[model samples]
Target: MSYKVIVNATLAKFSASHFLKEPFQCSRLHGHNYYISVEVEASLDENYIVVDFIELKEKIKIIAQSLDHRVLIPELSSDLAISETSESIEVVTNTNKRYVFPKIDVILLPLPATTSELLAKFVHDKIKEIYPNKRITIKLEETKNTIAVYKSN
Candidate 1:
């Protein structure tokens, strides 16, 4: 039988968030260098190889670059009725502070929470968008040990 191997890649989710919901309001308005890893299970065509590491690395880079250095706000989600303008993007937050992405390269992901679980699903969906038919597994980690994994069939 033939076997295949998968790989992992990660990027920092640079954004500020208030950790707790009420009272303490912990999060500290900080950012996380979110790490994202992807695994692709592919049996080599007839050559007994999984896939090209170079090609995979490039693809992963493209996705991470989109989110490398921008202020991530849940208000920037896809589900929100939001719009971007030349001057700035308007976001209504409980803190009532002005948070904006300084550059156009910054990407705002549509997720309910900045937690690991949401991040995993977010990356999985993003990869699926790039490669529609490939069965892939995704792992999103906030730090070295903390992580969330995802798979698509």
Candidate 2:
């Protein structure tokens, strides 16, 4: 039998997007209370039927600590209109206006836009870095009613 674990991490963020050929990748600037759920396939330890929630929380925390609250900039983000400085992030829109974000904050660079599907995959990758040879699944929820999952091969 396999055991599963779920961990909660407090998260906040900001971003923008617009579809192809449009201009921006997202509709407009937006943020969400992002939650990450990681599922590991392993037998329970000698004392329990699954890994301890605290241990799992620590594992998940390593990744979450870097992204808890800040701007999420997709490397695929359009326009190449971003500047990183010691104080703030300067985001210049396609139209030439700029938005600044405080530094010493979280800024995640995802390969894809901050959609649930892609975010799950991104989280899966981070988890893999911790367990190089083990299989795992990552689930991300933008809202309680919605979620996306990525299962490793």
Candidate 3:
């Protein structure tokens, strides 16, 4: 039999901005203070633990810090064009909406959309990179009432 361990720490928090193209109201730029929760599934080790909680928390913290206080752009979005300079990053949407942000304040992710569900998957993939053999679930809470979950087996 296998066991699972969950790590839900306040440290796993990030404040970031994104926009959704389909929903007109959501297409406007907005930000959220996102909370992340991670669950790891594995058999108990000799220490009688699925994994080291401290180590897992640290790994998630690293991922969260990278996204904190930044604007998340979908690098793979067909309707968006992104360009960068030493001082700033420029984004132009298919509708001719343009935004310029400081280079230090933007994170271009290789995703089609920066929705909560995709964000959960992104975090899950990042964790999987560090724990390739582990089955994992990642939950991203965009707000008090909205959350998205991604699971890998």
Candidate 4:
């Protein structure tokens, strides 16, 4: 039989800034208090356990802390022209909108965009690395009513 465990969004959250490529309002830089919830499914171990709650929460905490209070930049976006200096990173969209941010305040993700769907996959992959044999699901909430989900089988 298989068992499942979850780390709810309420207990695992982070604040970060990001922008999307389309959807006019989202194209402008903004920040959100993002929440991430994780669900892991796997057969119980010999000890009749799926996973330790504390351990899973700690791992999620680490990933959240890394993204907290940072500007997420998509390094793989063809729609963006990015440049960096010792102190700052500059970005310009294909539409010619420009932005400059401090290097220390940014996180360059290897993604085409920082949309919630991609971010959910990003988080799913991170957790998958830690639990290679288990099924993982990540629910990423960008706002109160908007959420994106990613699953790894």
- Backbone clashes in model 3: 0
lDDT of 2 by residue, 65-153 (tens): 56666666665667547777778777665566566767655374755456678878887887778766556788777777888989888
> Model 1 over residues 21-48: C-alpha lDDT tens digits?
2234443455667766777665566555
lDDT of 4 at 23: 52
- lDDT of each candidate versus the true structure: 0.59, 0.64, 0.91, 0.93
Candidate 2 has which clashing residue pairs, if any?
Answer: 17-25, 17-26, 18-24, 18-25, 18-26
What ranking emerges by TM-score with the best candidate at the front?
A: 4, 3, 2, 1
When 2 and 4 are scored with lDDT, the better candidate is 4
Backbone clash numbers for all candidates listed: 5, 5, 0, 0
For each candidate in turn, give its C-alpha RMSD to the true structure in angstroms: 4.0, 4.2, 1.1, 1.0
RMSD of 2: 4.2
Residue pairs with backbone overlap in model 3 = none
| Superposed model 4: Cα runs more than 4 Å off | none
Model 3: lDDT to the true structure = 0.91
Q: Estimate the lDDT of model 1.
A: 0.59
**Global lDDT of model 4:** 0.93
TM-score of each: 0.70, 0.70, 0.95, 0.96
Cα lDDT tens digits for candidate 4, 6-35:
899998899999988865789989999999
